[model samples]
Target chain A: MKQSHMAFMESGNFLYTLDRFKEVPVLYKGENIKEALQEKIVSTDSSLSIFPYGPSSGGMVESVYFDILTQGERIQKVSFDAGFKNRSIKLSGLSMGDALLRIERMNGVHSAAYSSMFCHIWEKGIAMDIPDQIKYLRVAMMEAERISSHLFVASRLTGGASQNIAHMNILLLREELLRAIASAFGHRYFFGVNRLGGISRPVNINGFQKKIRQISDEYREIFHTLMDSRVFIDRLDRSAIIKGENSSGPAMRASGIKKDGRNLHRYYEGLEFKTITSDGGDALARFMVRSGEIHESASIIEQALLHSGDLKPDPEVNEGSDSFMAGGFMETPSGDASMIIKVRDGKLESTGFMSPSILNMEAFAGSVSGNTFADFLFGYESLGIWVCEMGDFQ
Target chain B: MKAWILRSFRKGIITSKFPGGRNENASPWSTPPVYRKGDQDPYCPVGAISQGKADANRCISCGLCYPNYEPSMDIHGSVSSVSVPALKKSIRIYQIDVGSCGACNLEIGALANPQYDMARLGISFTNTPRHADALLVSGVLTDNMREPLMRAYEAMAEPRVVFAVGACAISGSLLGKAVSDTLRIDVTVPGCPPDPFTIMDAVQKARGVK
Candidate 1:
């Protein structure tokens, strides 16, 4: 089974592996090759100076340290240290229920994605089948999360370009969506809202589709205005190019790759969410893809709301899985975030998380390299990489 | 520029009358919770409730104690010891992220949106600690961030107000050690990730100290 799991992992496009936690320190024959290469990458010589940006600075939303090796104006390479904010959550030896509380906070903004993915994996392991209404409702909530996340990224992108009006309006739309979500569901960010087999809180998101449509309408105009603005267009165009592979979500789609994990799910079968793509792998392309996805995500929610029934008290998740390991892939707002878990005696033995931000960070480092210092923010914002989600876990 | 000017005028005022009025859009889960009167024994995962009492500083608002404890819908914040009264009119905040789930950071950023409009209260985020009157710290204080966190505080001018913003910072809330273990916090606002209203109320109280 371990060999089969390793074989299964080898068949995929992932670089990081679950083998790291299996007591085998090194997976590949040449383990130090990558580390040695990283050492050479960070080996900045005499002529060039390395500028350290953060650990804590107002320029970033999270505490992340960046070492940008530059020569006068142009950036040569960017190295980041994501260890500053490690919460050191030990998932192993905890009950599945206890492990979940940690996962929800692993990335609070992406709690919908993280919690849903964990529940899905656990359900599959236990051979538990979720009700159709619950699945439909999950789809709606996920899409709502996607919309708000995209709105935020869009706000940051426009704000980076000094397009204050577009930025403010996008924020306004996002606030409206968040309030609507809070009313439709219980929590604003869907916190404590995903149980193992069913939804945590009894929610009625049926009529909320109207509000989703309204916010969609409002965002469309801002989207158009942003596209029409030459200044905004120029700021993003030809910046941070990642010809998206080894990635999952908008970044992958933005790189002209049409793959989305949502397309493979049966719950999203009837929803009219399309996987959008772009020509250039730059910030402009990413912005375009995400802008289009916002509408598609809104449409998915609008349609998914119809299939969802007015959920009553959650079904009792009375069953449990013992001595089992389960893991799978998920398309979070960031990209394709995947996790592998080892369970024994109904407790988590060990867990491996590969958040989309990990892949996006490599792409971001590649994208920002050789570009002028001014392009760094646009590159970072366009990729939608969150350092908070970049931590490697057990 | 002209287009934006006209658009701003057309949009009208959507800002909240917070601090003056109540926060109309506060989320229940993100607000400080209160233990109910009648629950034989409530189980709080974070020890937020003990002996039929709830402590906001330690509550992660995991909702395990729900039906036994619920949100009070108030700002539920307090200025414990001191506040920088000189910053009563205008307070420029420099946010320091020690370590968080990114939720608390976004909630703080949300204050810039049309609904909260924290700028109306003369509150804005500064990119440098030198220009800031207060340091808004969020998340659990990690070992790696201790030096930087302290350096940021040292960089700030005298009469500086420090706000420990979420449950993680207040009591560590099961994630890590509380930030208060390192720094002297003037105000502590609690939630899993305290909503913008709670944060705003805390900020207001810190400035309005007599």
Candidate 2:
């Protein structure tokens, strides 16, 4: 297992120290990697032909370029340029509000994760403990977001299987959750909902939690039906197999690794947080882990909803007249996204974050290498790599 | 086949009453902003507000100026130069992401959901710009994607309109230059990421889809 790779290690921006870097670290330089990482892919095999997909295409949720090295059927390897939408967001010299604003926009699919992680790091840095009520509120928002994200992935898998009926149901569930989140937090993606010490707006957790549980039930029914479809299960069951030991998020958990950030977070212990894992490190296993987590997320939300108390927004963050680094990591909907910031003289001197999407993208590239060309989307979507999250700011 | 049909019909109508009137789906913060009170330069990051008039093109819907220039909850999605009067029947869209936070892409993609059912309005997403009637571009202009974004627009045939969807694409919000600065845009969808309803209505308006 890699403690860290040269990709992020040299930058010195990462919060976690690299005790032992992998001897042969995958020096993933974004767009171009196949040439170095896997020599087998760039072969002179007569049957093999390169096909480029995306960066500008329909059916893709975001802009990403995929270079498929294949023999018209089975793929020898796959290389992707997911950094096309990289805005290179550098949050240095911005106020706390501005930085938080930019953080939420980093990955709109899981804005809650980025913001909550920011807030978590900030609170830890300032040496202030978040109130128990605020903690539950934060946890509830994170879980709801996790449910939506997993639903999106499941929907993608079903869509790949051409299970239009099941796919539609999953999208319906996702939309319902989004609306419910908006109703509770005033914003759809929990933007501005999280503050340093408390949630910005008081949430009606009781109603929100019930709606989540109800959605979870409907989601389970749809997932169950999808599982019943042998074709759907077969398409992903033994496809794109990879060892998840080095992967992050559900990709890691799918391989039966019990290393979920929530498993260690003290706040989640009271909520009966458990790391859900599956046996096979295949797309189906990933799907199983996601499905199980959605239900678990609902249960966590239910427990968190018990303390439905109004929380006042924490006051504006004071700047450090004396500059010092303060940062930490938390389990986002994706994986452990760590953030470190230096505040000096009433200004945020600099900021850096390890957005889990980058690591997961690497995981996707590694897993999809030996699999057939057709298994590309299965392995890709299962890892849930938000391409826009790759460059710069976490 | 008969049982499939029966089961499909059993689900009943989940389609929304969009392209007609405002629905209950749009998030309050993601909607357009309208003026409320006196002159207050409450430091909008996007500079969406100037002289107390809120510009939807630049608004990211951050709600920094609450009470003064608050969320309008408007249904309309964008500000377009002109509608393609001939494209009233069916329109093919090719979406290009120059650089995005993923919200605009999701909101734009949301039009395909059962609730929106954009296909019902003769709208479909095409994989290639050659087959597209319009290009829906999201995110700010990133250096890496500039060429691909331009190439996509170039590949489109005549009567092809370009839509800069979201504050990022239209005005760059806080990221960088608007896609409109580089590419000629016919329509601009506001909000950090405009509500799908707003997008649906705007697309209809852009294509002159009665």
Candidate 3:
């Protein structure tokens, strides 16, 4: 055999080779790529643009740069630039409460998760526990946010498949959730709800409970229609495969990672909750994971709502403290989101946020590579990559 | 096929009745603020208040002012008298995110929801800037986004209108720096992120459509 040299790079568990020919059998770190590969190789090239808009990146944010290489119609390589960086410079030097407000806007889609995680971590660092009722309320709101976030992804997926009806239906369900959130939380996007110690305003427990039950039932019906549609499933299935171990959140769960933050969180430990996973790591798998999680989220909300009576209004627990430092972590709709806070003399000295979007960005190119150009949206939406969240992480 | 049609029928018509008059069912985030004699700046999270009155352009509608001051429905710059005759009737908008939190984008998306189907009113979102008669921009213009935004604006034909969609776009809020200095903002839809109904009202007023 004429020895041909090739190199391989790694993303999660998958080793990707840039070589066009398999006969070469790429090498990695002075070892044969084939010998070390636990999973199959993903070959990619980033040359021609597939989308009419070039890269076709729009979901969760306005723009994300995807450089696609195509041989005729089939995609050879897909690489992405994570767009312009939007640092959280405005957040620095603000009071703890003000910083929290800015953090919610860090990524609008992940606002609730960010605020919840910040409050959780801040309290932990400060050595204070939120009331059980407040914990339940926070869980309910986070779940609601998750439902909406997943629905947004599903809507984009269906819309990309040209299934307008399914797309419209999913969007409607999301809108219903938004309406409920606004009615209960006082803001459609759930901003300013989470504060340093606890929630700013009281939640309408009965109203939220009633709204969720109705919406969840409606969502289940709409989701069934989507799943039953052959076109919808066909568009998503096997198109964008993120290996089992390489991803997180719905993407990870879809690939059989039973890693759910709710499972480990103290608040959700007592709640009747189970992580949903799928063996397939494709777009359909991710879609399925999201759908399954929505049902789980609703169930968790109902369970939490049952104990809504235990909730107390925001207490002045250790408020106006001169010096304190804390960190909190929570699972958002996308994946693990966390925050760190340093307060000096009642003013926020500095704070940091790490959203799931940051980790998921690593897999964006790999997920879309080796797939057809038309299926690009399905892959991108399936991953649920929020650009601003990723950009704000540094 | 029958199942599909039946399911569609069950959903019924859910579009909002805007461009006619105010949507009677539309809920203001808070009742219009009744500016009392007391100082109210400390209560607001976004610093939307100046002197005594609430600046609707900067308000996020968190309702923090309600307990202390009576709410007002008066939205500043809600009325746009500058009628772009070229964009009358059917107008296509291209959305560009300079750097938004995602709320403004969703609010713009809400316009297409069943409650506010902006398409039915002859206003639609276009993927390409070339086809757009107006640019619906959200976000605080970041350094990287400014050039892309300007390029998008230039791609549009003559008589283009720029509709700044939120507090970030209008007044640069907390996240945005000053954006109006670079581009001519024809209309500013204020709110932390304006609701879909308010957005439509501003669009209708700008187009001067019947």
Candidate 4:
């Protein structure tokens, strides 16, 4: 398949270029092709016109460059000459704390995934030998994040339901879940806890298990109450319907596709869990599947905690060989977040990450096509875009 | 539905008495500072404490003190403003930078929330530095944002105060030692991002605002 065009108007800030591929095609105004090419564009103050092309590894633009094909009279293709280069991150030969700090500085899940992809690239080949226990734990955490995120989205969506009680309930429930997660993990968002090797820290099994049980019991009761309420159901039912192909993750799963990372079981083999799927695929169905997944996650966490062992830091694992590429997918709250890594000489040569938000963006664009603008927020909320944005770390 | 409403109403006000009484029961992570001398507390990364005395001016709002600090340390107790030794009595003001990570900014914004209504006290967040007292800043001043930050600081009237709210503002947080000449942050509040109570403590110290 031809590379899909993802055009970004170049801002004259940071552009990454190495001897080869100096000039790239950019669409100018009035359907014209113009190539504004230069070498060594760095620093926000430096005025340089260059195009930064990459699978990943780029910085925010200091200034935007418009394609001036028509003698500056009209505009052409715009490209952001992304500031900073990936090489700036001197990850090699760094202490564990420093490396983790660097990883944290990357900030946001996309950057996390990008750094992970870079790690994969450094490793040169994929490590299929990852412990099943670690894999299961990772999946559980990923699902937990998804569940709360979707719940929050649903809670926020109910603001339009004209019932302040339901909206406040959702918010309160969300806050409760957030506290529970924070209790389990040090950070509310669960950052820096999931390391490249396995997990940075183990869940406080007893405390976390209790919290999870309490939350699950509370949520089950609350959700059951909401579902049984015809008034609430009517507000959510068929309100923001999207087909399976048009939606992502639980939103798509509600429309009936049992594709879950837990099923893949690539990492966590012995972990027993149930995949929540619904056929209605409406706003209500999406909410139900998400709510159900919360239970599933809590179950998985409980299991992981029960089976917990000494969590030791993995020694610096070497990237097997150069010229190797591998991709890892984690089912984020929005959908599947895939990371592709290319390695050369134990260094990240090139990396690309497709955040679930990007996929959900596609899903949202497609789902909202026929719907009126008023229904846009409802449809968007049903798919859980705000939490997706948080996951995007943008 | 009718039954649920009645049950909820019976639950009574879950709203906290934060801005009112000195409620010790804050969030688990919401700890106010307790000044002690030379206590090896691992909560704060930067040495915000000297001889166990927490200089409210030096304290960064990084939640570490509450979570990872000494085991005996009460996170909720640390959520309240630490009384700092006064240099002079002056009305202190605070500023919020929207460009930085929203964590500290959100916590600062939470002051306006019904639960922690900061306006009930004399504290308030102002947009411009002209009407302000102290400046509350967050995030590592990015290379592109240096001018605006400096400009705001310059714009503040004399006898001004500046309190850095997060780790980013203090010690450049995770931005690392690589300092950008153009975008250098002046003050530092530490933590991945500190809680609001930490911020409240800092503001109180700056302006002597009760």
Candidate 5:
């Protein structure tokens, strides 16, 4: 009979492991590694073994048993079983309202990604027909969210400089943007209005378009004011330096990669907008790029609203099929987020999410090496980690 | 430096003049809800507002009653004369808690800010029952809070004003039907958390200060 092992990782930074084995296997060259001494020096056909483990930082050690069919301990067939912490979201037997409420309780970016992931998996994959208009609208909305998040991060970074005026100004602007978002969609941070097949509520074209224009003008004036502040610029410059070659996504593009999802032509084909770039792959460059992207997003929204003429609503799905796998990639405020889904029997089989922060945490660890500890916070803030800090329940 | 200083100065005095002259630039949602006579009242989801009984202590600030109720209610609508059980020259106010989310607390705390300045109007938030004139509480009546809430009300000096800030406090909107507790609140201001101005107006009405 085969045995299993389980490890529990606690939230407050502790790891506990319980391992059980039914058979005591003969080992070669194990005298150096085995710490516990065996009693009676007897070879038994079967024995039970239990081992406890702790965090080693050298990756978890998980192993399983296999019956050896060959000589010299070389097995013909081997089965490996390993288990770690399970932290995936479960969305089952929930109404749309309840589902959205649950998502809102999640981290804000994760909530956005979850919605986008669902749309990507079910709508785009099964329907096989997503209107260019809806795609463009989504891109525009995503860019808006990105700009808002970046501005908030930049504001916090500037707060360390005692530039409370800029900080307050940015917060006010963020609040206004949130109001606009709430007006457009029902909820501010969590747009519970997005549904499968199509939008639950049609965009108030006139009001939303006008608000976008106003926000654009306001952003231009505010960005100019922020740029004028030498203190702000000084603090932002050469901070959180990431080598252009190593960085990817918006961070890289802002650091002069010139690669943009908006330019992918699936949504933004022939869309007239400026692609802003900076040679300096530093905190200020990231800030400037995000600020510039706001104007670009405003332009996209204007175009989308203008082109959205007499559009027909898409058909709704009463039920969905199974055994389908779909993945989606969206450029959020911090960086790119990808969601992979596997659906079976009209329910999600397994879902995986890769957030920019998870990847950027490594980048942050790399960048902060040999730098002063004070720079760590500024560097992290520049990456837009702080925007969702208050929103993190888990 | 000079330009920056000038810019800061030019932004200029955006402070409010409250508790003195008429409040100019009052927040659009500042006015509190008022019960009126000869009008068919809408049933408050939380039962914070009804025909004759307006319990300020039960208000949850959910903003469902003022515009939603019949008789075209405003936040600053006149308090009905017939509804009062007691007649006193000076009205006393108190805030108590049954069960509330933290939004009302923050909004009430906002009174301490430079904009509202409730202290100038002789209104202050007091933690203890002895110092409190009115118990300004927000939330639905939960089982655990019933005894404590009643005790607080009993402890009040007398002629107390209990102002409920949201629909939750008034009739227990979402929490009303399911709540097993027999506790009740008074004078509900409806809104998810009634706007700060609505709270101020409610406070004024409770004290006959307006």
Candidate 6:
């Protein structure tokens, strides 16, 4: 009888072995590697294994499994097994509200972005008019979420270099933002806040604005301190290079892409917002981009708050269609997330989600190909790609 | 480095004095759902509440339960009073994500921050289950993850605690029948994703925090 066992390799590799039989390489991304290096692969029957769950991943979702072949301390070939974590998100036959709830769970932290995209797509299919204040509120919520998400990435990147103090400071800032969100909407993750046509409740700007101001001040001080640290800068500089159009969100902005979905939104037409860009296209660049976006997000929130008082109860409109299909694109903290929905006879027929993680994860393999093991960790933390978000597209 | 030290000194104890001091900052989800006059069926989109009884294991904390109800008025949270005999010395936890959406993981991650500072209570997160006294499992337990979860559990020494950390982990939430029902979970912390304070309280309690 042959039995299969999963094995964990050092750094970037995972293997499955058959008992008392030679290891058969489960080839993936096989064409990406050169023909000359294919002969260097080694097959072994017995190898030390660690369960490929969250423990070894430094608290990341255990959804991703990478298989790497290293040659003399350098990663020669890389492949991944991302199938083990796929959660089939079948939206057919469910009502719009229930569908949105399911989509929210696709990525816990990025729920608002997913819900907004889904609702936007569904509403547009029926061509429902949205109030200007509602758009502003959506943008405000996205910016707030952007701040919290970026802080988490920053904390992880800092923590990767053993800077626990810096990690804790950024996490503390993130907690403060989460508290503000909770105080305003009564939920930390912003679930159920983005309803079709308008927000579920009125905006509470004063308290949220005050918290954003304090967070900005504290963030500036702490970020400046982190920037001045030579060790931290050294670890991040020139690591994980995802140049040109290969990246998105801060990663793309860090690589000098001037594109941002906020510019396309009609509500942001008059708001004072600027897309920040960097030339490094490395880990430090991504980190700096996140730092810059904190300030930008804060400014956007301030502007949005100024107009929040003008929001009126959205006019009641019935958005019913016998057969309709609509698509939407929105800029999340990570990147552009696109959602498409098809409705027939007041029920969902099909839906598609293209989360930013798919594009970012594709770029990840190339970024870490030539880097060392330590740089791989830095690259992953800096990219801020959550495996959980990939279910919608995978 | 010097600046960080000075800043840390100035900040002085930012940690929470929880279960002892005022927990005015408890999360909204920490409170149970209440009945209102206008709330009809589907009070919760995920069906966390039914017939005025809230299932903590199924609630995602979307704040749709009682739209008019204010979470700040009432205070409810974990009792923060469990004393495991075997874990009195200290507890090292290992987290496993069977199939999560990342919220629960973040909540657990937040426990390490200064506010919660779980390390002060003799609880720490280990990178391997072999060194762990508790297996902190999150997300809905899918079939593919069952073997690995069992292997992780088997690796730990006897008298190990398995803590189900979120709604999906506790009752599979929306996944329903997809979640496996094998292991006998020792502790169940509920929420769409439980707050860091709640997570801290659960871990502390599991480690015999008085």
For residues A155-274, what per-residue lDDT tens digits would candidate 6 score against the true structure? 988988888889888888898889888777667888767776876544455578889978988888989999888999999998878998877788898898888888896657788977
Scanning candidate 6 chain A in windows of ten residues, the lowest lDDT window is A15-24
lDDT of 4 at A325: 64
How would you encode candidate 4's per-residue C-alpha lDDT over B1-210 as one tens digit per residue?
785687577656665555345533323322335643334654344466555554433343333343233222233222213333342343445454423433454455545443444565666655456766666665555433333345556676765656666555555544422222223333334444455554555555444444
Provide the lowest-lDDT 10-residue window in model 4 chain A.
Answer: A55-64
Question: Which candidate wins on DockQ?
Answer: 2
Please identify which of the two predictions, 1 or 6, would achieve the higher TM-score against the true structure. Answer: 1
Q: Model 2: residues >4 Å from true position, as ranges? A: A1-45, A310-322, B1-11, B37-39
Over B169-200, each residue of candidate 5 has an lDDT whose tens digit, in order, gives 55554443212123233345555445455566
Interface RMSD of the candidates, in order: 11.2, 10.2, 11.7, 12.4, 17.3, 5.7
Ranking by DockQ: 2, 6, 1, 3, 4, 5
Error of 2 at A367 (Å): 1.7
Candidate 2 residue-wise lDDT, B1-210, digit = tens? 343355468768888977665486778888877788866666677677788788887888777666576677786757778788777778888888888888888888888899899998889988899999989988988766766776677787888888998888888888776886567788877877788888887888897764
- Pairwise lDDT winner, candidates 2 and 4: 2
Top-scoring candidate (lDDT)? 1
Instruction: DockQ each candidate and list the results.
Output: 0.42, 0.46, 0.25, 0.12, 0.03, 0.45
lDDT of 4 by residue, A1-394 (tens): 1021111112222122211113323322112122223212223324333222221111111111122221122212222222211113344444333344444434332223333333333332554356655555555555555556655666646665655666566556555555565556545555445555555544543365676677677767777777777776776776556676665678789888887765663544677888889988777788888888888877876776666533544543443444556766656566665656555554555545555554554565445333433444465567754221222221
Evaluate model 5 with DockQ and give the value: 0.03
Query: What TM-score, computed on C-alpha atoms, does each candidate reach?
Result: 0.90, 0.90, 0.87, 0.61, 0.54, 0.89
List the pairs of residues colliding in candidate 1: A248-A336, A249-A335
lDDT of each: 0.79, 0.77, 0.70, 0.49, 0.49, 0.72
lDDT by residue (A58-164, candidate 5, tens digit) is 11110112121221221111111111111123555433333433343233433444454456556655655666666655655665666566656655676666677
Tens digit of lDDT per residue, candidate 2, span A149-244?
999999899998888878887888899899998777767777667655666554655478779988999888777767778889988987777684
Q: What fraction of the true interface does each of the listed models get right, in terms of native contacts kept?
A: 0.70, 0.65, 0.30, 0.02, 0.00, 0.43
* Model 4 spans > 4 angstroms off: A1-136, A160-162, A196-203, A228-240, A280-282, A309-324, A344-346, A369-374, A386-394, B9-165, B168-189, B199-209
Q: For residue B83, give model 6's deviation from the true position in Å.
A: 5.3
- How much is A45 displaced in model 4, in angstroms? 46
TM-score of 5: 0.54
In candidate 3, position A382 carries an lDDT of 84
